[model samples]
Target: MGQPIFYGSVHVLFYRNDEVLLLKRKNTGFMDGMWSVVAGRIDGAEEVVSAAIREAREEAGVDIDPSGIDVVGVMHRKNTSSEWIDFYLKVKSWKGDIVNKEPHKCEELRWFPLGDLPETVIPYVKSALARNHDRIWFESFGW
Candidate 1:
């Protein structure tokens, strides 16, 4: 036996009023054209919450305080090649104007009503958000 290998990612949801920020994925072969929140793979030796803050800034050009982030849910998923552990975080506050910092990787950034997200949202992302946070501490997909 060997050590288990799982790729970890962090996602942050930025909300204003009744809307949540989402980005249209592009050029990323995994889920091109799908809507997703600000997210990225965790870098080496970085904490999950820190990764969430970093991703929010990197993807949306916003600065988020650590104290304003809340861990909402986690999803453990598997594709044909590998496993993933995705941490979902909700941001209570942030600074700076939100913009698409990575135009090449993202097509556009927009805000959508939390209750009526776009039909093209990534399946797991939609599933995670639709469920009550307290009811879904962890989720598994493509087992």
Candidate 2:
């Protein structure tokens, strides 16, 4: 077999009262123009938590203390392919405003309430939020 690709992405769901930070991806790669939380691939030889913190800073220009962010669960997404995703939930905290650093990868940034989320949100993120109500931690959730 040829070289295989195994992706490890970390996502953190941040809630401010009712609304949450979401990014509208630009017309680029997968799920372009869709809304999703802070996400980025885990680098080789790097810790998973560091990836989440780095993604938050790089994607949204936010500084998150790695230890403060709680790992809600790990969802093994298998939509078109299989990949491991580490899910974190930061209920009440975070500094700096949400800014779109990667213009090529994102177009707009907005905060939507939990009760009234946009239809463009990625299916996996939607499922993550809904299922998070039960405090489900460390389990596989489909995309």
Candidate 3:
């Protein structure tokens, strides 16, 4: 086989009432203790849209209404591993209370205003949030 087919991931940016949802990673993994949006790898035969919805439900314990989330453009990121991130904008109201179910993967989950976000946010995610509604990428990291 040639170069391995890169796997894509779906990321959801759920913003409401001037606050955005972020989770602090706790377990041992890449970017642990960092704050990030609900993201998950897209499984084979699974569409990115469904992945986004599933991730939000599983990670944040939020049931997203299908009619609400909108699929945004894809983001191509080339680091140690190259990937095409399928971006989705979920602005609709969701049911169920927010809970940090996966403490191993996430320590705490909370919403913060855009202007006063925590410093532990994943750098790439921070850039993405800053460029919400705009396709222009403002930053890049080799690693």
Candidate 4:
């Protein structure tokens, strides 16, 4: 074999007080009708932090400073068809009003209490959020 390849993506947990922002995916073919955070695939040659900031802006219409975000956890996820490495970043503060920037791909954006997330959240996303960020740095899903 030459090498192994995995898709890389970033997830942003925008926190406000006791809540975290979630967007209901709509037309996205992968996980339509499920709730997820601001997220996207890393562009070629882009730094992970830069990808996080770009995703936040593209999905939620928010601007996040690199210094204001924390890489809370990472997940190595694999299913029947593909594998992905996902970085979960936490942001307690950001600029601009949060809106559904991609109305065609996302249905609506809402905030849910960190302690009580909705049942519709994406599986791996829910797993990442349930982790004790201070203690765990990585997790694996779907074997």
User: How well is each residue in 32-70 modelled by candidate 4, as lDDT tens digits?
Assistant: 999998999999999998999999988888898899888
Q: How close is every model to the real structure, measured as TM-score?
A: 0.92, 0.84, 0.84, 0.93
**For residues 51-142, what per-residue lDDT tens digits would candidate 1 score against the true structure?**
99889888999898899888988899888888899998988888899999999999999999998999999988888777665433888988
Question: Please, what are the lDDT tens digits per residue for candidate 3 over residues 36-84?
Answer: 8888788888876677778888888888877767775456566565645
Q: Quote the positional error of residue 139 for candidate 2 in Å.
A: 4.5
lDDT of 4 at 29: 89
* Model 3 bad stretches (over 4 Å): 1-4, 134-143
Task: State the lDDT at 111 in candidate 1.
Answer: 92
The number of clashing residue pairs in each candidate reads: 0, 1, 0, 0
- Which residue pairs in model 3 clash with each other? none
Order the candidate numbers by TM-score, best to worst: 4, 1, 3, 2
Residue 82 miss distance in model 2 (angstroms) = 3.7
Question: Per-residue lDDT for 1-143 in model 2, tens only?
Answer: 73545577787777777788888877667898789887877899888778777888888888877666767767777656655655556534667877888887888878898899999899878777766544656656564
lDDT of 3 at 106: 88
lDDT of 2 at 89: 61
